[model samples]
Target: MTRIRISSGSRFEEEIGYSRAVIDGDHVWVSGTTGYDYAAMTIAEDVVAQARQTFENIAAALAQAGCSLDDVVRVLFIVPRREDWEPCWPVVKQYLGNARPASTLIHAGLQTDAMRIEIEVTARRPA
Candidate 1:
């Protein structure tokens, strides 16, 4: 099988030597993605907006890997503050609720205070 690496043009990917997502055969693994709008390089203060942007970013990466949110089999969410999770739930449900992927939420510190959420996902292309 050949390995394909997808880049979101984030400076950190090059600095950290990591691809945003990698595809090997039918599987796709998207790296932990933050809420930063790569084009504007800014994140929203509100968690809801951040959550929306986060999914948008993930969708783009998945598209590059020839998949979509519906193809995801698992999802992981990281939040610096537990309280912020509920506020972001609506957006989360809007995207992944129907797919109902195996999901996990972790309360942990992120790289910055402004960064409230980060999400990572694993997907498989149907054979």
Candidate 2:
């Protein structure tokens, strides 16, 4: 199997030495994506907005891997505040409703208070 890497051009990728996503054969594995917009280098204060941006970031990485949300087979969501999860559900549904991937959510400390959410996904090209 051949391996390919996708970079989102985020400074962290260089500093931490990690790709945004990796494609190995037909499988795509995306890193934990935060709400910070790589181009804008900004994050929204509202949790819902952050959630939406998180998915957008993930989507971009998936596109680079020649996959889409529909290809996702598993998802993981991390939020510092449990209450914030409900507000982000609609945004999550808008992007992932069709995929209906197996998912898990956890409440935990994040790197910064500004970051409200982080998402990670694994996808496989349909056979």
Candidate 3:
């Protein structure tokens, strides 16, 4: 099987030496993505807004990998503040409710304070 790499043009990816997502055979692994709008390099202050943007970022990466959020089989969410998690539930359900991927949430520090949330996902391309 051939491997393919997809980039979101985020400086962090180049600086950190990682692709936004990688495709191996029919599987796609998206990197931990934040809410920063790659084109504008800005993040919203609210956790809910950040959650929405984070999913958009993940969707873009998935699109590049020839898949969609519906193809996601697993998801991981990281929030620096435990309190911020529940506030993002509606946004999470809006995006992944249909896919209903196996999911996990972790409370931990992120690379930046402005980044209230980070999300990562694993998906399989449709057969």
Candidate 4:
């Protein structure tokens, strides 16, 4: 198997030495993506908006690997506070509403002060 790195100008990736996503044949592993806009590099204040941005970022990575949310077999989400979980859930539901891949949520710390959530997804494309 060969590894292909996928990057989309996420500063952390450049500074931390990891690709936004990695493709190994039919398997695509998208790194955890925050809500920060890649272009503006800004994070939204509202939890719902932030969650949407995070999903969009993850979608972008999956698209690079020749797949979409439909191809995602799993999703992992992290939030800073327990109270934010409910607010974020609808956002995840909105984007991956029908796809309904196996998902998990964790309440913990984030990388930056402005960031409140992080998302990582694994997807498979037919060979």
Candidate 5:
């Protein structure tokens, strides 16, 4: 099996010596994605908006690997505060819809205050 690396223009991958996502056969593992919209290079201050953007970013990485949110098998969320999780959950549910993956939420001290969310997801394409 060959390892395929994906980079979604995030500096973390190259600077930190990591790929945005890595594909090993049928599975794609996305790195922890933040709410920073790289197009604008700015983070959203709103928790809900950040959650939506985080999923969008993850979906972009998956799409590049020929996968979609419906293919996701697991999801992880890191938020600065627990209250933020409440607002984020609804927005995330909207994006994932009926394809509920095994999910986990953690309260964290993020690298930036503007970044209210960090998300990671795993997706698998049928063999």
Candidate 6:
């Protein structure tokens, strides 16, 4: 088995000393990802919009790991405000309903106030 590190080019990864995701054997573990559009470095104010962007970021990372959202087996969601969680349901379903991965949601402050949602996931590449 070989270990591989994937990067999203987010400055935080370099500054914080972490890879966006790591591929160890058949598993892909993505770091807690925020909604910032890495290219533009901007995040939407709406939690729903942020949720969508967060999934996109995760999808990109998964893609780099030779998998997709459908390959995800576990997911964790973190939101600063509990109320914001329900509003993001539709976006979550839209992106991850197929995989229906085991999931957990936690209410906690993020690295930045502007980040309404942060998502992390674990996936396995198809055998």
Residue-level lDDT tens digits of model 1 in 1-127: 8999999999999998999999999999999999999998999999889999999999999999888999999999999888999999889989998689999999999989999999999999767
Candidate RMSDs in order: 0.8, 0.9, 0.6, 1.2, 1.1, 0.6
What does candidate 4's lDDT look like per residue over 1-127, in tens digits?
6899999897788898999999998889998888888999888988888889888888888888888988888889888878888877777778887688899988889888788888899899856
Better of 1 and 2 by TM-score: 1
What would the TM-scores of all predictions be?
A: 0.97, 0.96, 0.98, 0.93, 0.94, 0.98
Give the alpha carbon lDDT tens digit for every residue of 1-127 in model 2.
Answer: 7899999999999999999999998999999999998998999999998888888999999988888999999999999998999998899899999999999999998889899889999999766
Candidate 5 per-residue lDDT, tens place, 4-97, comes to 9999887777788999899999999999998888888888778888888888999899999998999999988898888888867678878787
Model 3 superposed RMSD (Cα): 0.6
Assess the local accuracy of residue 113 in candidate 5 as a C-alpha lDDT between 0 and 100: 83
Candidate 5's C-alpha runs over 4 A off are none
lDDT agreement of model 5 with the native = 0.87
> Looking at model 3, which ten-residue stretch has the lowest summed lDDT?
63-72
In model 6, what is the error at residue 112, expressed in angstroms?
1.1
lDDT of 2: 0.91
lDDT agreement of model 3 with the native: 0.95
- Stretches > 4 Å off in candidate 6: none
Q: Write the per-residue lDDT of candidate 6 for residues 5-69, one digit (tens) a residue.
A: 99999999999999999999999999999999999999999999999999999999999999999
lDDT of 6 at 81: 97
Worst 10-residue lDDT window for candidate 1 reads 89-98
User: Which TM-score value belongs to model 1?
Assistant: 0.97
Candidate 3 backbone collisions, by pair: none
TM-score of 5: 0.94
lDDT, candidates in the order shown: 0.93, 0.91, 0.95, 0.86, 0.87, 0.95
